[model samples]
Each structure stands twice: as C-alpha cells, then as structure tokens.
Target: MRVLVTGVTGFLGYHIAKDLLKDGHEVINFSRRHTSEVDELGIETIKGDLTNYEDIKNALRDIDAVFHAAGKVGMWGKSKDFHRINVDGTKNLVNAMKEQGAKYLIYTSTPSVVFGKDEIKNGDESLPYPKKYLNEYAKSKSIAERFVLESNGHGILTTSIRPHLIYGERDKNIIPRLIQRAKSGRLKIIGDGQNLVDINYVENASHAHVMALKELSTEAKNQGKAYFIGQEKPVNLWDFINKILEAKGEKPISSKVSLKIVYFIGLIFELVYKLLGKYDDQPPMTRFVALQMGTSHYFKHDNARVDFGYSPKITIEESLEKIKN
Candidate 1:
C-alpha cells in the first residue's frame, strides 16, 4: 500500500509513519513543515498546508490510504486559527480524498471530543459529542472527527482513533510540560488528587493507528466509527505524573489546589488575556486544564480491541524505563 501520513512532522504522526514503513508500505508524508525525521526516514514528502484544498488534492494523487494525523492542538489559541487548521483543514482533506478516490482515511482524533462539564469514567465510543467543548482544540477536533466519520462510504472508508494522555520518546507535550512545572516547583495537584485517567504510551498509540489503517475498508466493522485506544489500565492522574517526575529525577508535586478556585482563577486569566488580545497565550489555569486535572476521564477500549485487535504494546512500567533511559 502507498500510504500518505499527514503531519509526519508531529510526534504521533511521525511514529505512525515509521510503523507503516516497518510494515513495508510505501509511505509518503504530507506536512507544512520539513523536519529531520522525514529526511532521516527518507520517505517521499509533499510540502503543503491542510487548509489549502489544492495542496491536499495534489498530495492524494497516488496515495492508497491516509493517516490524517495533522491538526491544531492546544488548550488556548485563536478559535479561528484552530478552526482553520483542524476543521477547515479536515474539510479540505475529506473533499480531496473523495475526488482523488483515496480508499481509506484513519483520523487521529482525541477523547476530548466527548469531554464536557462532567467527569467520565470508563467512557466508550458510544459517548456522544459534548453539548459544549471546554476549549478550542476540543471543539475543532470534534468538528474534524465528525467530518472524517460522516464522509465514510461513497467509495471512501473512514474511521477515527481517539488516544488519550499520550507520552513517551520524542514527546513534545504532556510529559514534557509536567516535568517543566514539577522541576520549577510550580506544579500542584488539582482537586482531590485521586482522579484516574487513561495514558497512552507513544508507541502504543501509534500502533493503534497502524491497526486502524490495516482494518479499515469497505464492509469493515471499523468503517465510519470512532474508537478510544489507551493502556489496558487507567492510572491515578497525579500518581502517574509523580512517576514521570521521579524518572526525571525531580521531586513529586505536593501542592494542592481546589478545582473551584482554579476554575475561577482560570476565568480571570482568560478575561485578562482576551482583553489584552493575547489569543495565542495560554493561561496557566484555564477551565479546560482544571477540569482535566480534577476529573476522571478513563475510557474503555473494548470496541477498538474487538474491531481491529487494538491493545497497548507498551506498559506503564516499560514507559517509565524508556523515560529513564
């Protein structure tokens, strides 16, 4: 298969590309930025923007399947920018895929799409999109995931994989951010410090993408559906953070803050930033972050397992070893 991996410059997308190459597929990358990984992997790449329909159409010319892993991800950003990159970008991809007759599309979605005002435990793909999203990233991603799923069939098979709290080698977010704050002594346990959540090691998350790509097709059970993939077990959120901090040789976070106070502080930060017109700046305690840190959001991957034989290839113990090395 000639596979085109979008966002090969990104952390997860790069890993997905590597997995496809390992499987002896001819892999092409479609990304706006040129990175050493692409050059190092020696995969053919088409430099283009996702918002540009022409670029996506051209990128799909000879591609058999696409691992659409590109998107604007953030807790704070200009809503318009997120929409342009995540929503409009996906629209262009879906339309271009149809026009180019690309057979399969596997979107890299998020569990945040279903996140709302309440905490979710053991949530499944059956959970519907929230009535209101906590942040621009979730809103835009929800829209994009919907586009990818609804655009299924009509000669194009499509599905979305939602992975949560991903961390591991070459990680640009999540773990890195935690380590920075922990080392700086600014990290604190939000709420009760007992919330459980799903964490996906990078390799495990990327393998889920590979599994989806392999199983997606016409008449396939995975077609047009979304699946949540993560470690087989959920971990205590703060305990997990402490493990990473320990591996990085930093003291664990001991301070604690109430979710209500943090949420209020976040509201104030948001107002100040908005008034100052700093849409690109992220507030330290945004409502979204407060909810995420304070709530339990583990998911059930039974559907992913049943549909495409998905499972975490790396355990938390293995992940800690990788970080220590």
Candidate 2:
C-alpha cells in the first residue's frame, strides 16, 4: 500500500510514517518544510499546505491511504486561525481524497471535542460534542471531525481516532513543555491531584492509525465512526506527570492551587492577552488547560479494539522506561 502521512515532521506523524515503512509500504511525507530525518529515511516528500486544495490534491496522487495528522494544536489561538487550519484544512483533505479516489482516511482528532467543563470518566464514542467550547482548538477540531466522518461514502472510508494526551519518546510538545515549566519553578498542581486521564503512548497511537486504515471499508464497522485510543487503563494525571519528572531527575510537583482560582486566573489571562493583541504570546493559563488538569477525562478503548483489532503494542512501563533511559 502507498500511504501519505501529513505532518510527518511531528512526533506522531513520524511514528506513523515509520511504522508504515516497517510494514513494507511506500510512504510519502506531506509537510510544509523538509527535514533531514525524512530525507535520511528515503521517503518521498511533498511540500504543501493543508489549507490549499491544489497542494493537497497534488499530494493525494497515487495515494491509497492517508493519515491526516496535521493541525494547529494549543490551548490558545485565534478562532479564525484555528478554523482555517483545523477545520478548513480537513475539509480540503476530504475534498482531495474524493477527487483522487483515495479509499481510506484515518483522521487524528482529540477527545477535547466532547469536553464540556466536566469530568468524563470511562467515556465512550457515544458522548456528544460540547454545546459550548472553552477553546477555539477544540471547537475547530469538532467541526473538522464532523466533516471527515460525514464524508464517509462515495468510495471513501473514513474514521476519526481521538488520542488523549499523546506522549512518549521524541515528544516535542506535551512532556517537554511540562518539564520546562517544572524546571523554571512555574509548574503547580491545579487540583487535589486526583484527576484521572488517559494518555497515548506514541507507538500505540500510531499503531491504531495503521490498524484503522487496514480494516476500514465502506461496509466496515469502523467506517464513519470515531474511536478513542489510549493506554489500557487510565492513570492519575498528576501521578503520570510526576513519573516523567522523576525520569528527568526532577522532584515531583508539590505546590497546589485550587481549580476555581486557577480557572478565574485563566479567564483574566485570556482576556488580557486578547485585549493586548498578543495572539503569538502564550497565556499565563487558559480555562481549557485548567479544566483538563483538574478533571477526570479518561475513556474506554473497547470500540477501537473490537472494530479494528487496535491494541497498544508497547506497555506503559516499557514506554516510561524508554523515556527514563
């Protein structure tokens, strides 16, 4: 099979492309910039933007499957920007897939799409999208997921995989930022430190994408559906952070702040940032970040497993050990 993976420079994208190559598939990396890593792997490269229909159409040529993993992800961003990249970009991909007769599309989505300022322990795919989104990123992603799933027929097999708190080796965003904040004495527990959350090991998350692509079809159960992919069990959010800190030779986060106070502070920061026209600057905190840290939002993976034989090939212990070393 010939596979096209967008955002191949990203950690998860890189993993997906690598796994495809290992399985004896022709891999084409789609990204705006070239990286030495991709060149060294001898994978074909396509330079393009997801927001451009022609660019995406060109990349879709001779592609049997696609992993649409590119998006602007963050707690803070302009609504228009988020919509353009996440929502509009996905629409472009869907159109290109249709134009070129691509059969399978496995979209990378986030569980935050259903976040409604509440705890969601053991949630499943049946959960509805939130009525009010606290962040533009989530809102845009929800719209994008809908577009992808709705464009299911007409010889296109599409499914969305929502992976929570993806982290592991070569993680450029999540854990690295946490460690940086911890080293700067700026990290604090937002709640009572009892919130549970599901996290995806990079390998497992990418493996799920491959499984979905292989099993997806017009008559397949996974077609047009969404599945939550993560570790077999949920872990305490702060406890998992502490484990990573320990691996990095840093002491655990001991300082604590009330969720209510932090949420109020986040609102103030968001307002000030928006007022000052500092779209490029990071907010001190955001309500979405506080809610994510202070609540339990783990999900069950039975749907993914039953639909496509999705399983985490790497254990959490093994993943942590790899990071530790």
Candidate 3:
C-alpha cells in the first residue's frame, strides 16, 4: 500500500508516516517544503500546498491512502487564513482524493471542536459541535472535520480522529512552548487546579491512526464517524502541567488566576491584536485557552476500540520515561 501523509514535518504527521512505513507500506510525504525528517525517512516526497488543488491531485494521484494532518493551529490567527488552510484545504483534499480514486482518508481533528465554554467529562463522539466557538482554529477545524466526514462515500472512506493535548518526543509545539512559558512565569493554574483533561502520547495517537486505517480497509464500519484518542485516563490539567515542568527542571506553575479575569483579559488582547493586524503573534491568554485550561474536557474512545481495535501502544508512564530534561 502507498500512503501520503500531509504535514509530514509535524509531530503527529511524522509519527503517522513512520508507523505506515513500519507496516511495510510505501509512504509519500506531502508538505510545502522539504525537511530533515523527510530526508531521514528517505521516502518519496512532494512539495505542495493543500490550498492548491493541482498540488493535492498530483500528490494523491498514485497514493492509496491519506492522513491529512497539515493545518495552521494556534490560539490566535486570522479567520480567513485558518479557513483557507483548515476548511478549504480539507475540501481540496477530499475532492482530489475522489478525483484520484484514493481508498481511505483519516483526517486529523481536534477535540476542541466540541469544547465550548463548558466542562465535558468523559465525553464521547455523541457530543455535538458547539454552535459557537471561541476561536477560529476550533471553528475552522469543526468545519473541516464535518466536510471530511460528509465526503465519506463515493469510492472514498473518510473518518476523523480527534487527539487532544498530544505530546511526546519530537514535539515541536506543545511541550517546548509550555516549558518556555513556565520558565518565563507566564503559565499559571486557573480555577482550582482540579480541571481534568485528556493528554495523548504521540506514539499512542499514531497507533490509533494506523489501527483505524486498517479497520477501514477491513471492516469499514468506522467510515464517516469521529473518534477521540488519548491516554486511557484523564489527569488533572494543572497536575499534568506541573509534571512536565518538573521533568524539565522548571519550577511548577503554582500561581493562581481567575478564569473569568483571564477570559476578560483575553477578550481585550484579542481585540487589540485584531485591530493591530498581529495575527501571527499569540497572546499570552485567550478565551479559548482560558476555558481549556480551566475546564474539564476528557473523551472516551470505546467506539474507536470496539469498532477498530484502536489502543494506545504506549502508556503515559512509558512515554514519560523517554522524555529527557
């Protein structure tokens, strides 16, 4: 089998590519530019943008399956930019896959799609997309996930896997930024530090992707559905943050801030950033971040397991052992 992984340079994308390769499948990396990781993998790569239909079609022409993982993700960004990449880009991929007669599409989605300004305890795929989103990233991803799921039939099998707070080795975004913020005294515990959330090990998340894809190839029961993948259990949000900080030799974030205050501050910062056109700069706090940090959001993957045999190959304890300060 031949697989094309978009955003192969990214953390999850790289893992997905490696998993596919390990399974004896030929992997093609899709990205805007070449990276050392692709060179290390020594596989075929196509330099392309998801926004370009020609690029997508060219890459998917001979590909058997696709793992769509590329997108602009952050607490802040222009709505149009996010729409172009997350929404429009996914549309282009679906269309190109249909045109190329690709067999399967496993889209990388985020749990934030269903997370609004509320607490979700042991949530499942039965949860509905929030009618209103506090950030553009979540809203755009929601749209993109819907589009991918809706484009399910007609010679293509599409499903979405939403992984939350994914972190592990070669993580270019989550942990490093977290450590930096902790060192700078920018990170803090919001609420009572009792908010529970799901954090995914990179290996486990990659395993879910592979298992789900194989299930699609075999049983085909998971098409047009979404599944949440994460550690087997949810951890207290602040406790998890402190554990990472401790592992990195940084002081644990002990300062407390009110969620309401931070949310208001975030509102002001968002207004200022939008007015100044500083779309690239991430504010220290945003309403979405505040809600995420201060709320309880964890999901159950029983459906994924029952339907596709999706299981985390790496446990959180095993994953933490591999992390170095």
Candidate 4:
C-alpha cells in the first residue's frame, strides 16, 4: 500500500510512518518542515501545510490510505488558530481524499475530547463527547473527529484512534515537560494523588494505526467508528510520574494542592491571561489543566482489540526502561 502519513514529523506520526516502512509499504511523509527523522528514513517526502487545500490535494496524488495524525495539540491557544489547523485542516484532508480517491483514513484523536471536568473510569467507544470541552484543543479535535467519521461511506472509510498520554523514547513533549517542572520545583500533586490514568507507549500506539488501516473496510462495523487505544492496564497517575522522575535520578513531586484550590487559581490565571490578550501563551493554570492533572481518565481497548487485533507489544515496565536509558 502507498500510505500517506500527515504530520510525519510528529512523535506518533513519525513512529507510524517508520512502522509502515518496515512493513514494506511505500510511505510518503507529508509535513510542513523536514526533520532529522525524515532525512534519516529517506522516505518520499512532501512539504505541505494541512490548512492549504492545494498542498494537501497535491500530496494525495497517488495515495491509497492516509494516517491523518497532524493536529494542533495544546492546553491554551487562540480558538481561531485551533479551528484553522485542527478542524479546518481535517476538512481539507477529507476533501483531498475524496478528490484523490483515497480509500482509508485513520485519524489520531485524544481522550480529552470526552473529558468534561470529571473523572472518567474505563471509558470506551460508547463514551459521548462532553457537553462542554475543557479546552480549545479538545473542542477543535472533536469537531475534526466528527468530520472524519461523518465522511465515512463517501467512498472513503475513516476511523479515529483515541490514544491517551502517549509516551516513550523520542518523546519530545510530555516527558520532557515533566522533567523540567520537577527540576524547577514547580511540579505538584493537583489532588489526592491517587487518580488513575491510561497511557500508551509510542510503539504500541503507532501499531494500532497499522491495525486499523489493514482492517478498515467499507462495512459499517469498522467504518466510521472510533476506538480507544492504550496500554493493557491503567496506572496511578502520580505514581507513574514519580516513577519516571526516580528513573531520571530526580526527586519525586511532593507538594500537594486540593483540586478546588487549583481550580480557583486556574480560573484567576485564565482571566488574567485573556485580559492581557496573551492568546499565544498558555496561562500558568487553567480549569482544563487542573481537572486533567487531578482526575482519573482511563479507558479499555476491548473494541480496538476485538475489531482490529490491537494490543500493546511494549509493557509499561519496558517503556519506563526505554525512557530511563
């Protein structure tokens, strides 16, 4: 299969493309910028912006399937910016896929789309989108997810994979942020510190995409459906973070703040940032951040496992060792 992976420079997308190449598929990377990974992999590359219809259309010239992994991921940003890249960009890709006759589209979605300022235990594909999203990132991704799923049966079969807290080797964002905060003494437990959360290793999460692509059929059973992808088990959130810190030879986070206190502080910071017109910069605290850090949001992957035979090849212990080394 000639697979076109958008955002191939991103953590998940990069790993997905690498796996496709290893499986003997002709991989075409579509990204706004070239990274060392692309140069090293030496796969065919297309420089394009998702927001541009022509750029995306041209890149889909000979593609058979698409891994639409590009998205604007952030806790804070201008609503317009998130809409442009996440929602509008997805619309453009869908249009291009229609025009170019691409058959399958696998989107990389987030569990935050269903997060509504509450604990979510063992969530599944049946979980509904929140009445109100905790942040703009989730809102935009939700809209984009709908666009992709709703587009299914229009000659293109599409599915969304919602992977939570993906982490492992070559992770440029999540783990590094944790280490930086621990070093700066700014890291603190937001709640009672016993909340459980789902996490996915990069390799396992990327493999889920491959499984979805192979099993995607025009039949409704697999088409237009969304699946939760994660490790086989959930871990206590604070315990997991502390383990990573210990692995890095750093002290674990000790300071604690009640959720109510953090939520109030987050509200204040949000109001101040909005008043200051700091649209590009994230506030130190926000309601979304508070709930995310303090709540339990784990999910089961029974649907993904049964529908596509997806399972994590790397255990949590092995994943931690990869991070430590």
Residue 197 shift from truth in candidate 1, angstroms: 0.3
Instruction: Give the Cα lDDT of each candidate.
Output: 0.90, 0.91, 0.90, 0.90
Q: Report RMSD (Å) for each prediction in the order shown.
A: 1.1, 1.1, 1.0, 1.2
Ten contiguous residues minimizing lDDT sum, candidate 4: 214-223
Q: By how many angstroms RMSD does model 3 differ from the true structure?
A: 1.0
What is the C-alpha lDDT profile of model 4 across 237-314, one tens digit per residue? 899999999888899887899999999999999888989999888788899999999989999889898888899999
Q: Candidate 1 lDDT, tens digit per residue, 95-203?
A: 9988998899999999999998898998888898988886999999999999888888876999999999889888888878988887777799999999999999999
**How does model 1 score by TM-score?**
0.98
The residue-level lDDT of candidate 4 at 307 comes to 85
| Residue lDDT tens for model 2, 262-312 | 999999999999899988878989898999999899999999999999989
Candidate 1 regions exceeding 4 Å error are none
Q: What does candidate 3's lDDT look like per residue over 31-133, in tens digits?
A: 9888887899978789999999999999998788999988999889889999999999999999999999898999999999998888999999999999999
Best by lDDT: 2
Lowest lDDT block of 10, candidate 1: 212-221
Steric clash pairs (candidate 1):
none
In candidate 2, which residue ranges exceed 4 Å CA deviation?
217-219
lDDT of 3: 0.90
